[model samples]
Target chain A: SQTIHQWPATLVQPVGSPLSLECTVEGTSNPNLYWYRQAAGRGLQLLFYSVGIGQISSEVPQNLSASRPQDRQFILSSKKLLLSDSGFYLCAWSRGNTNTEAFFGQGTRLTVV
Target chain B: AQTVTQSQPEMSVQEAETVTLSCTYDTSESDYYLFWYKQPPSRQMILVIRQEAYKQQNATENRFSVNFQKAAKSFSLKISDSQLGDAAMYFCALGETSGSRLTFGEGTQLTVNP
Candidate 1:
């Protein structure tokens, strides 16, 4: 079975602080990875997606960035977090080159205080 | 770009009743995939059902089914004999044939009254 792990599950960071959210997948290799953010009472917005290590596509221009350090390891980072950066972040993966449904992680709820 | 729309922001159903949540999408690509995802208070996304645009027959899974209208570009989810546990935020998403990423719609919050 394939599973995704994301942490720290919940976070509270001060404005202008650095931020890093990690997501890793187990039981799969070379899967397509994605990062999405959902604002309060709003729909999800695609942040970044990676087909392989070091290959990233940004869907929106914002105050954040994503990196794939390993085949299954994806990191979302920001040099200086802003108040508008707070939201629910989700990590998802799908089978490479297949039109399969995506499996999502537990999601991180970050509150910028 | 592909976009999905869920007109209803919230819907409620009594226990054991059937309720259909509506979803419509616009896409330029002929071949694609549509999906319904459930997000409980825990906020973990669970795939409820999926339909391939090339398939003509509607897809069903036990109590959950999808009414796939490819020509109309509409895909709606029907929940029969709804349960209290079914209460969650339902999201409709669209995926391209390349299978890179998904475009989600504004979610519909389903409330099941016990």
Candidate 2:
């Protein structure tokens, strides 16, 4: 069984503060990882995805960036946060290149103050 | 680029009744997959059902099923004998067979009434 862990279930950060959200997967190797953000009452939008370590593909231009430091460790970071950056962020992983089903974490609810 | 559309922003159904949520998608790929995910108040996304583009037969899983019309590029989810637990946000997603990326719809908030 594979599990994804996302930390700081709820975060309150001041504007211009640095931010880092981490996600990790267990029981799988070389899995595909993705980061998605959902605004209040809005659908989720894909922010970044990584197929392997040190490789990331961003779907949108925004105030955030993602990195895959380890095989199963992914981090979302921002140098300076903005009020508009607050939202619910989710981390997901798919088994392999051919697996269509993705498993998601509990998600992080960040509130920028 | 692939896009998914869920026309209904909200829907309601009586308990034990049947409700269908509509979904349509635009994609240039010939091989792909469609999925319906349920997100309850807890907000944990769970995969309800999935359909492959090359499959002709509709996919069903217990009370949840999908009507996949590949030619029309439409996929709808039908929930039979709806229960209170069914009340949640349902999302339609499109996945390419060659890639692991998924495109999600706007989502439909389903409210099951007793």
Candidate 3:
């Protein structure tokens, strides 16, 4: 079975601070990875997706960035966080091929004050 | 660019009753996929059902099923004998044939009344 793990289930960051969220997948290799953010009572917003290591596509321009440092390890980072950056961050993995359902991680909730 | 639409912002159903959430999408590609995801209070995005564009038969999983109308570009989810745990926000998503990215709808919150 495939599973995804995300760290710092919850975080409280001050404005203008650096941000780093990690997501790792097990039981799968070369899977597609994606980063999404959801505000309270809002829909999931696609931030970035990666097909392979060092390859990423940004869907919406924002204060966040994503990286695939390893085959199953994805990281979301920001040099400086903004108030608008506060939201629930989710990591998802798919079979790389199209038309495949995506599996999501536990998710990280970031609160900026 | 493909777009997903969930016309219903919220819906309510009695326990043990059947409820259907509506979803529609717009896409120019002949080959694509539609999906319904459930987000409970915990906020975990769980796949409920999926429908392939080329398939004629709708997809079903246990108590959940989807009505896939390829020509109408409509994909609706039906939950039979709704349970208390079924109270959550449902989202409709669209994925293109060439990309792995998914475009999500605004979501419809389903409330199960006792």
Q: Best candidate per lDDT, number?
A: 1
Clashes per candidate (backbone, < 3 Å)? 0, 0, 0
In order of appearance, the predictions have TM-scores of 0.98, 0.98, 0.98
Which is superior by lDDT, 1 or 3? 1
Instruction: Record all residue pairs in model 1 with backbone atoms less than 3 Å apart, i.e. clashing.
Output: none
The weakest ten consecutive residues by lDDT in model 3 chain B span B94-103
True-contact fraction per candidate equals 0.83, 0.50, 0.65
Ranking by DockQ: 1, 3, 2
Backbone clashes in model 2: 0
Q: After superposing candidate 1 on the true structure, give the runs of residues whose Cα lies further than 4 Å from its correct spot.
A: none
TM-score of chain A in every predicted structure: 0.98, 0.97, 0.97
lDDT of each: 0.95, 0.94, 0.93
Structure candidate 3, residue pairs in collision:
none
TM-score of chain B of each: 0.98, 0.98, 0.98
Q: How much RMSD separates candidate 1 from the native structure?
A: 0.7
